[model samples]
Target: MSRLPLAALVAAFFVGLAWFVSARQALLLLVGVGLGSVLASTRFSFTTGWRRLILSRDPRSVIAQLTLLAAAAAISMPLLARFPTELNAALGPPSISLLVGAFVFGLTMQIADGCGSGTLYKAGLGVPLNMTILPLFALGSFIGSAQMDWWLALGNVNPIGLVQLYGPIEAFGITCLGLIVLALAALIWSGKKTPWFDRRLLIGAIALAVLMGLNLIIAGQPWGIVYGFGLWAAKIATASGFFNPSHNWFWSQPDNSQILSQFVLLDVTSITNIGVLAGALLVSAGKPPARAPRLTPTQWAAGLVAGFVMGYSSRLAFGCNVGAVFSGISTGSLHGWIWVPMAFCGTLIGVRLRRYLNFSG
Candidate 1:
C-alpha cells in the first residue's frame, strides 16, 4: 500500500481504539506522532545541540531548543493557571540526587549520543546505536525507579514550581526573561557570522512547544519519558514474576498500581511513546536515506554503558531531557533550571571523554 493509505489505516485503527478506550489517549497519541514527525524532519536534538555548543561553538541547534523552551513556557503557563484541575506541572525537588543525576544524564547523552527522546526517535529511524541504547535505557529506568526512594532520602527539598508559587504571569515572565538572556549569550558566544536560525528548526521548536502543551492539557500531566520506560520494564518484570510491585516505594503507590494493572496502551505516556516511534518511522520512510554511523565494537560497548547510565540517572534525577529540561523549565520548575547547567557541565566532560575514546564524529 502507498504511504498515504498506510497512514489512513493507522489513523483509523487509533481512532477506533480511541472510541473504545478514551478520547484523551487518542489525542496523546496524535501529539506524540506530531512530536516525532517534527523531531525526525528537523533532526532537532538536545544532546547534539548542547554538545555542539560546548565543543564546536555551534549554536543553531541550541537556539532551536531555547525557542522551544520559550514557546512551551508561554503556552503552558496560561493553561496551568486557568485549568489547574486538568493540568499538571513537571515539578521535581532540587536536591543532591537531582544535581548528581542531571550531571550524569548529561554526560551519558553526550557519550551515548542521544537523550531520552532522541534515542527513541532515532531508534525508530533505524539508527543502530540508538536501537541498542534504547533497551539499555529502558532497563536502567526500571532499576532507577525501583531505587528512587533511597535516592530521595539522600537530601531533597520540596519541589519549587513558579506556577504554583507565584502564579502564571510571574512564572512566564521569569522563564521567558531567563531564556532570552540565555539565547543572547549563546548567540554572542557562537560569534557574529553563524546563521542565527534555520527555518525548519524554528518551526520544529514552536510545533514541539505546542504539542507538549497539548500533552499537558490532554494527559492531565506534563510530558514525561522515564516513567513510561520504567513502567514498561516493570510490567515485563512483574509478568515474569521477577519483580513485585506490592512493596516498592514507587510502584506501590495507588496511582502507579492502577497503571501497572492496565494495558500499556491505556497509559498516557506509553501510548505517546509508541506514537513517537511510529511517527518517526513514518517520517523516515518518506525522507531521503540517511548515512549510517561508522562505529567500532568498543564504541558500541561504550554507548551501551552510557545508555544504561542515562536511563538510571534520569530516574534518580527525576527526568531526562524531555522530562527534566523541556517540561520542567516550561512548567517553571526550579529543577529544570538546575538540570540545564549541571548537564552542560557534564557535557563538557563527556566531550573530552569522547576524544579519548576515539569516537569523534
Candidate 2:
C-alpha cells in the first residue's frame, strides 16, 4: 500500500477511537496530531531556534518563536477573559522551584537535543535518540511528580497570572509589548540582521499559533506536553504497584487521583500525546528516514542522563519549553517569563557541555 493511504487509514482508526472516547478529547487528539505534523513538516523547533540564536547569531527561529508567542497571547487572552471558568491558563508559581527546574530543563533539553514538544514530535518522526529519551523522560517525570511537593516546599508562592491581575485586553497588550522588546533585544544581541521572517517560517509560526489557540479553545486549557508524559508514567507505576497515587502528595490530589483511575484516553494530555506520536509517524512514513548519529559510550551516557534530568526538572518547574515557556508566556503567567532567561542561561551552559561531551553541534 502507498504510504499516504495507510497513514490516512491509521489516522481514521484513531479518530474513531477518539470519538468513542469523548468528543472533546477527540478534538484535542486531532489538534495534537495537527501540532505534530506541523512540527515535523516545518521543522519548527524551540530548541533549534534558541540554540541557533545563542551560538550562530541566527535570529530567524527566535523571531518566529516571539511571533508565535505574540499571536498565541492575542488569541488566548481574549478566550480566557470570555470563558474564565472554561479555559485555564498555564500558570505556575514564581518560586525557587521554577527557577531551578527551568534552568535544569534548559540545560538538559539542549544536551538531549529536544524539549518536551521537540522530543515528542521527533520521536514521532522515529528519531532514535529522541525515541530513547521519551521513555526515560517519562520515568523521570513520574519521579519528579512524586517528589514535587518536597521541591515546592523548598520555597514557593502563589501563581501570578497577568490576565488575572490586569484585564484580558491589558494583559494582551503587555504581552505584545514584552514580546516586541524581547525581539528587539534578540536582534541587538544577534548583530546579524535578517528579514523578520521568510515565507515558510512565517507560515509555520502562524499555523502553530492558531492551532495552539484552538487547543486552548477545545481543551479548555492552554497547550501543554510534559503533564502528559508524567501521566503515562504515573499510570504505569500505579498499575505495577510501584507507586500509589493516593500516597503521594501531588498525585493524591482530588483531580490527580480521579484522572489516574480513568483510562489514558480520557485524560486530555495523554490522548493528545498519543496523537502527537501518531501524527509524527504519519508524516515520517513518507519522508526519507533520518540516520541515527554515531555516539561514543560517554556521549550516550551523557544524553541519557540529560534526558532524565529534563523530565524531572520539568515537573519541578511546572513545564518544559512548550508547557512552561511557550504556553506559559503566551497565557501571560509570570513564571512563563521567568522560565525564559533562566532556561537560556542553562542553554549557554549546555552548549558548552555539548562540546566537552564530544557531541556534534
Candidate 2 has what TM-score? 0.96
* lDDT (Cα, 0-100) at 168 in candidate 2: 90
For model 2, the local distance difference test gives 0.87
Query: What residue pairs clash in candidate 1, if any at all?
Result: none
TM-score of each prediction: 0.96, 0.96
Global fold similarity of model 1 (TM-score): 0.96
| Per-residue lDDT of model 1, residues 1-361, tens digit only | 3458658866985887689888888888888889888898889999888878877788998889999998999999888999887788999999888999999998888889889999999987888889889888999999998988998899999999999889999999999899989999999888998777878899999999999988998898888888899899999999999999998999998999999999888899998888888788878775655566699988988999999999999998889999998999998899999998998888889988887888766
C-alpha lDDT values of all predictions = 0.88, 0.87
Off by over 4 Å in 1: 5-9, 286-289
- The residue-by-residue lDDT of candidate 2 on 301-343, one tens digit each, is 8998999999999999999988898889988899999999999
Give the C-alpha miss distance for residue 209 in model 2, angstroms.
0.9
